[model samples]
Target: MIDKTTQPALQRLRLNLRQLEVFLATARGGSTRAAADRVARSQSAASTALAELEAALGCELFDRIGRRLQLNENGRALLPRAQAIVDQAFEAQDLFLGEHAATLRVGASFTIGEYLLPGLVSRWTQLHPRSLIQLRIGNTSEVLDAVAAMDVDIGFVEGSQTHPDLVMQSWGHDEIVVIAAPGHALAQQCATPQQLSQATWVVREHGSGTRQVTDEWLLGHLEQVRIGFELGSNEAIKRVVAASDGLGCLSRHAVEQSIADGHLIELATHLPKARRKLAIVLHREKKLGRGASDFLAHCRAAAAF
Candidate 1:
C-alpha cells in the first residue's frame, strides 16, 4: 500500500538527492546562478532546489547576500559532508562511466610537485596504466583553495595546516637550509638571525609554505632578512642565489644537487634545524577513490624509501 504522509518527499519532488546536488553545485560554484549552469538548469530551478534542500535538511545551507550565495558557518560545516556524498556518488558513477577515463586530480604546492611528486605520479601511472593523473601546482595556500573547491583529489603541502575543511596528515618532512653563492660573507660568519636579516634575501612569493614558516621564524629579526626579490620557483630562487651575492632559503632536497657540486653552501644558523612538515591534505568529507587511495599509498611508500 502507498503511504500518504511521505508523498511530498517520495512522490511529489522525489528524494532530496537532486536538491543536495544543487546545494553542492551552488556551494562549489559560489552562486545558485552558476550552479544552474553547471547542472544545465535554470537559475530559479537551482534556487528552488537549494531552498527545498535547506527546508528538508532543517538547516540554512547558504545565506543569500544580494545576488550571491555565501555559505554561513552552518553551510561551511555541511560542505565537507556534502562533498563526501558527491565524491561517493561520483565514484559510483565511475562504475557505469568506465573507470579508465576517470581522472584523478591532485594538488601539490610548488616545492613538492616540482621536486618530488613527478617521480611518484610517474610510478603510479606505470602501475595503473588505465588511470589518468592530473596535477595542479601552487603555493600551499592556493593548493588549499583548490582542494576546498573540489578541484583536486588530494594535496601535498609544506607548512602547518589551517583550513577547517581539510584534514592534514604528515606525509614527510623537509629540512630548510639557508644558502648563498659559495663566497658570500654570511657563509663565513656565524649565521645569527640578526646577521642573516641584515642582508637582502630573495624568497618564495607570499603564501608559499616556505615563505610562511621563514617569515614566522624570522619575526624578531625581520629587519635582517630584508626582501631582495620574491621569485616563484625554488629552482629560480636557487639560481638567483647561485649567480648573485643574494642569500636564499631552500629545501635540502631542492639544493642537494647544487650543494654537492659546490655552487650553494648551507649556512650554519645559530638557530636549530629549520624543518617544515610535508603533509597530505584532502577534504575531510571527500572519500578517496580507488585510484586516489593507490596514489596516497604510493606517496607514503615513496617517502619511506
Candidate 2:
C-alpha cells in the first residue's frame, strides 16, 4: 500500500539515539570535539551524526560562531525531547540487568537533604544494594534550577515554591519550631509578641525554604523583628543561637536532636504554629527512568504513613 518515494522519506525521518546522544553532548560541551569526548566517538563521526540529524529535521539546530556552537531556537526546542528520549533508552537498557542496576540523580534542598533524605535514602539503598544515587544538596532556588536544567532527575524541597517548568507534588509536611538555648530568657517563658519582636534572631539565609517560611510566619504575626544573623547552614544557626542569647527558627527535624540533648529548647511563643508542605519536583517534560521512578514510588510509600 506504500509508495517507493514515500518509503525513502519515512526512512530519512527516522532519528537514531546515537544522533541524539551526540546532539546532547554537543549542546552541552559546545563543540564536535567535546561531543566526541563525551559520547566516546571520533570528532568527525560526531559531526557527521549532527549533520544527519539537522538534515532529517530540516532545520539548523545551532548557531555557529567560530568554534562555538550555541543552541538556536530549533535546538532549544528539541533539547528536552531529545534528552528524554535518550534517557528513556538508557533506562530501558538497564531494566533487564535488574532494577538495582540503574543510576539515579536527585537534588534536594538543605533541610530535606540533611534531615529527611538520609533515612529514606538509607532505606532505599539497603533494598537496592547495587543501585547508585547521586544526591546534590542546595537551597530551594538551587534545587529548582537543577531540576529545570536536567542536572538531576528529580528534586525534593520544602516550602511552597513553584517553577514554571517543573511539576510539584506534595510529598509530606514539616513544622518550623522556634528554639533557644536552655539558659536563654525565653526558654522557660511563654514569650509575648513584643518580646519576640525585640529579640535578636538567628535564621536561615536568603533563598532558603526555611528562611522563606520563617520570614512569612514571623512577619505575619509580629510587626517587625530584628535579624541578628543569617546563616546558610541549620547547624550553624543552632550553634550560634545556643552560644548566644539570639533566638533561632528551624525545622523540627533539624532541631530535634539538639532539643533532645538539652542543648536547645523549643520556645513557647504567642505566635501561631508554623507548618509547611514538603514537595517532590520534576521537569514537566521529563520521562522518569525506571530506577528514578521506583525511587519516587519508594518515597511516596514511605510518606504515606
Candidate 3:
C-alpha cells in the first residue's frame, strides 16, 4: 500500500472532479448503461470516462465480466478514499462557486430525527439564516456508517458506535423503556425481573438500536422470554402494542407523544432502568463547516437527555 502520508499529494496527480464523478456514477449504478442513464451521457462516454479515470490513476478500477464492469479489488480499496475526496470536493464547492462555505449536512437516525431535531435545526437556522442545513434521516446503524464513510458531515444517533474512524460525543442520555397499551393489565402492577421475564414481548426488527439494548438487557436473564413479534419503525411497533397484549422496547423520547395521548404505558416497577447514551459522531479526519459547528453547539447546549 502507498504510504498514507504521501497519498494526498499523489492523489492530486490523478484526481479530477469529472473523472471521480464518472467513477462514482459507475460504482453506484453498477453498469455503464445504468451510469449513462444517470449521468445522461452515452454508454461510450461513460466507458471512456472510466478508462480515462483508470489510466490517470495508473490502475484498473474495475474488471469486465461478461458485459458488466465489476469493481476489482483495487477499485474496492479505493472506493472509500475516492468517495471521501468526492464528498470533500462537493463540500468545498460552497467556498467559491455557488453559496458561501456555510452549509451544513447533518445526518440523524429516526428517533432523534423525528423527536429531537426539528427545534435544534430551527434554532440554528434562526441564528444563522444564511447557512443552509440539510438533514438526512435513517436507521441508527446506517447513520453511523454514513458518518464513518464521510457521506455526511455529522450524525446524531441513539446508541454508541465503535468504529475507529469515528470520534463519538455524548450528546445526551436516553432509556429503552418497555411500553404497552395504557390500560394493559401490567401497566399498574409491579414487575420483578422474574415476572417481567414471563411476559411475551413485541420487539423491533433487527438492526434497531432499541432492540440491541433490549437484547443486551436480557443477556444474563430471560433466556426463555418469548419475542411475540418483530417489526420495523416505532409507529408500527406502537400500533401493534396499542391494539394487542404485547409489549415492546422504545426510546423514551420517541413515545412521549403517544404516552401522553394515553396510547402506551411503562412496564411496572423499579426494575433497573436500562439507560442508553444519545451521541453525536463525526469522521475522525473530516473538517467541519461553520454551519455544522454551529448546529452541533446548539445541540450540546439545548438538547436534554
Specify the highest-lDDT model's number: 2
Residue pairs in clash, model 2: none
Q: For model 1, how does the per-residue alpha-carbon lDDT over 87-142 read when each residue is reduced to its tens digit? A: 67767777876554468889999889888999888888887777788899999999
Q: Of 1 and 3, which scores higher on TM-score?
A: 3
Deviation from native of the Cα of residue 204 in model 3, angstroms: 1.1
The estimated TM-scores of all candidates read 0.79, 0.86, 0.81
Residues 13-91, candidate 3, lDDT per residue (tens digit)?
Answer: 8657777777877876678888888778998998888888888779998888877777888886776667667667766
Give the Cα RMSD of candidate 1: 3.9
Q: Could you tell me the C-alpha RMSD of candidate 2 in Å? A: 3.4
Residue 170, model 1: Cα distance from true site in angstroms? 1.6
Lowest lDDT 10-mer window, candidate 3? 94-103
Q: Write the per-residue lDDT of candidate 2 for residues 12-65, one digit (tens) a residue.
A: 566999999999989888999999999999999999999999998999999999
RMSD of every prediction: 3.9, 3.4, 5.4
Q: Model 3, 187: alpha-carbon shift in Å? A: 1.7
Q: Which parts of model 3 are misplaced by more than 4 Å?
A: 1-14, 32-43, 63-73, 76-92, 96-104
lDDT of 2: 0.92
